[model samples]
Target: MKKYSYQKCTAIVLAFIMFFSLFAGVNQAKAEAGLNVNADGAILVDGETGKVLYEKNADSPLGIASMTKMMSEYLLLDAVKHGKVKWNQEYSVSELVYKISQPTSLSNVPLRRDGKYNVRELYEAMAIYSANGATIALAEVIAGSETNFVKMMNEKAKKLGLKNTKFVNSTGLNNKDYHGEQPQGTGADEENVMSPRDVATLAFHLINEYPDVLKTASTPMKVFREGTTDRIVMKNWNWMLPSLVYGYKGMDGLKTGTTDFAGYCFTGTATRDGKRFITVVQNAKDSSGKNDGYKARFGETKKMLDYAFSNYTKEELVAKHYQVKGHKTIPVIKGKEDKVKIYTKSAINMVIPNNEKDNYKPVLVLDKKKVNKNGEVTAPIKKGEKLGYLTIEPKNGDKVSFLTEEGQKKVQVDIIAVQDVEKANWFVLMMRSIGNFFGDVGHGISSTVKGWF
Candidate 1:
């Protein structure tokens, strides 16, 4: 009887352990299935604020195919803006550009040495169709040669604060096959590489600096060199536009790329009810067994977009001239007034996930400290002088993090003085000294009494 009782207890304990293990497995599977993305790297960002909403291996440097053309496009437009080039200016096709236009290539607009194209035509082909040859032509026009153009690309990447990005060619092609004049200081082994985070940064700059690029990028199809019988019809390759299955309502201009080494990649932007978001996916599955030519890249993009739009909302967390609650009244000594009111230096707003918004808490961190010798804040403070910063975070028990405009994890803004405070007169100084003397005496008595307790 004793042996049977012991055996029954052992069986019960083993059954409980097995049940819990199965339950835990099911929950883990559910969580993974909800966010199962096939992309090697991905990121979703709030467009205006540059806040990263979601990311997976975003900072890992990887080959970015034709997405390199976005930077190339930026330089072209910037040159035009700076009067270095004109929109109608025509450029001759170089031997290298013609080679890039070979029919056997992945995608090309078929450039001919005999054909002279304007800057506008080249820019359109490069952006809308991901035309490699057209991109090389434009690069040559701007920097005199692709080698010099690549130097400019790297320089701009540095200016943009991209830590893990390097460009070997203006066109996003792999560098191993290039037999032409090599990029200065680069052995033909280098290929254009950028992290998904850097790619989103590049896109945000493109849209913010030159919003006009979107006008051309949003076009579904347009005829190049119209009215000519040999004019080529170019179609936009981005599938997230309104006409496709994964299409969202406000989807618009961006870029896409695919290569054997790079797999498939895309950077996309969309707006809904005045809120905009940017998303980037890199090195996604090249085939979903659908044989439709488009890989899992587009599907992964849709998943990210849907999650962002469905879960988040644009909120005005704080406003310009908005007085911070606890930090508004700052003690001031030797000043005309006893205290100075403070206000935010600028407006503060962000896209917060709807579920986390209720738990959101705004905190103001000031640089000033109260010194017993001087009493609170020293006077002669100028209005609009930067005192400190305001930061926003979620309340306790919340797992989500917010992002600042600079893409940092914490959202922070400047805290400025609302009014100027001049030094106090002699009479006012004497009154403050008397009050402080008595206040110290009373504090000593209270401390002595507490010690007795």
Candidate 2:
């Protein structure tokens, strides 16, 4: 019996060790599933609400390579939107544009001084191929000079509330030696500087203002000035899009940047199931000159995209017409009905982490100071009228309160009245008045008797 007991005890110990080993492995995988980016700065955000899902050195200012064209792209698109320029309008390439286009090492579509291309073709070349010469030509056409265009780019950046962004040239190339027309705020360094956060901000604004740019950004390859057989083929630099090994399910266009000083950078965006996300990876490696380091930005971006789509979920936090807990009905003053039901104006959907799904708390607060200061809604309340706002916050120790890409907390939704309350009839009013008069008289008598005593 003693021998048998010893063997059973040993077997139970082995089973316990095996169970813990599997549990540890799963936990480690879960923790390591997230992105460990090898970049100077990075950020991932919800494209719709601009909420930050992940960040690392997001605010640190660094050299942004070809990403500066996003601002140029924005101004050009805005000009087109405002009827300043048409897609078919042709712009002449200037001598300055030709000189910048001479860099054989950099990306360019080779715009000659006498070359004339339409706005649509130039924009596509700049956005997809990161053609510096095409961007310069577009800038000059819009603002008459690249220097003036840089000024406009800075102005737009300021208007977007970008604190750590500055533009020296339309192209993101290092221009310290080039002594052409310089913008007002440009330093001698001559390369645009922007944090990853600011880059994401610019990307968001670009997509929001001009969604058509995505069509250009996502194109794998297209002929420049497509009617001639000798036209150059411009292929997109962003590898996260479709037809690439690292391509995600819903991966789409944004931009990519690389330089000896700036390192490898990429701002990637994707959409899945009607939800979209944007990621910015900046200064991904010091040896961006090498092939392995140049591809680090895409690898890091893929990791971030994968983690966000896999670990988080968008769920309906509050459904429409759903009665709020704690306060069931609000009192109606001088109404036939005693009270009315209140609910959210629309359904509240929130993107929460998989582990934190049940940890969030929705706190509902009525705007007593605005509509119902005295804690009562007057009669003749209309249905669907905005009563007050419902602020939903995470419970204590919950990590749902993430910072937004715009550097602010998420704003909660507002709740409204679900039904109307009609005014009370004359008979009911009269009966209530009579009851109040008798009650006042009785109170007066009781006070007088107490005074006598």
Candidate 3:
């Protein structure tokens, strides 16, 4: 009987352990399947604030294919803005451009050998159809040569704070595709490369700086040089557009890229109900790795968008005029008031996960340069004077990041003085100084007496 009882107890314990193991395995599987974006690198961010919503290996540099045109588009728009280039400016194709445009296998709108195309038409072809010849043509016109334009691209990348970006050519094609006519400084087999994070940063600046580019990017199709013999119908490769096969609602202007080296890549943006999101998927493939193509890249982007819209919403975590505890007021020296009240200059709103609302907390950071040893500001404080900063952090210690490296730190708002504080009158200052001197002497005398006792 005793042996049987012991055996039964052992069996019960084994069954309990087995049940928990199965339960844990099921939960782990669910977590892994949450957002299974099959790609070499991917990222999603809020278009307005550049806050990173999700990321997967987003810092690794990889082939970007035709997305390199985004940088070209930026420079072109900047030139037009600054009066350096004009839409009606004409470009005469060089011998190298003519040869590159003649390849039937490449994505090109065949150019007439003796024809002159204006900036507007070539821009449409490059932005809408990813035409390599048109891109190189613009690069030449803007910088006098493709080689010089590449230098400008890298220079602008640094200016925009793109950390992991490099431009080998304006067209984002492999140098080998140039057929020995590659840009002067690039290698024969080099391809333009950028990390997903850098790509998203570039897109963020592009959309914010030149929103009109979306007008061309969102077009479903257009005829090159309409009403002319050389005309060809150029359809946009971004299938996620509302007029395309996938026809994702709120989907619009962005870029798509594909090559044997880059596999498939896309930088997509969409707006819905006053909210916009930007997503990038690099070298996208399926779990089986057999469906690495145009569809795969779009599919992965949809997954990220769906997850973002479903789980996150904009919340005003801190209200304007908010005063941090233990930092509500700052001492004022030689002023009419002994201290001045301080509050946040503006409210801080962030798109955060629904379940993590209570996890955030406020942190105050005072500017040491403006304050004295006692944390006091001198007289003559102006209303709304910025004195410090208020930054937000998650109490749960969750990692929060942004699309740009500079935004990696937490979001912050300015802390300013609530009202003006002028210098005290001379009579008041004299009386205060006399009182302080006497108080110090009395304290010293008291200390000496205590020591003698």
Please, what is the whole-model Cα lDDT of each candidate in the order they appear?
0.81, 0.80, 0.90
Q: What is the C-alpha RMSD of each candidate to the true structure, in Å?
A: 5.2, 5.4, 3.8
* Predicted candidate 2 versus true structure: per-residue lDDT over 193-283, tens digit per residue: 8998889888987886689888888988888866764378887888777786566678887989888778888889998876778999878
lDDT per residue (tens digit) for residues 344-438 in model 1: 87766678878555677778777755324433678888988877788777787545432224554235778888899999989889988998999
Decreasing lDDT order of the candidates: 3, 1, 2
TM-scores of the models, in the given order?
0.81, 0.84, 0.90
Point out the higher-scoring one by TM-score: 1 or 3: 3
Off by over 4 Å in 2: 1-33, 177-181, 286-291, 397-411, 423-453
Regions more than 4 Å wrong, model 3: 1-33, 405-410, 447-453
Against the hidden true structure, what lDDT does model 3 obtain? 0.90
For TM-score, the strongest prediction is 3
Which has the better lDDT: candidate 1, or candidate 2? 1
What TM-score quantifies how close candidate 2 is to the native fold? 0.84
Clashes of 1: 1
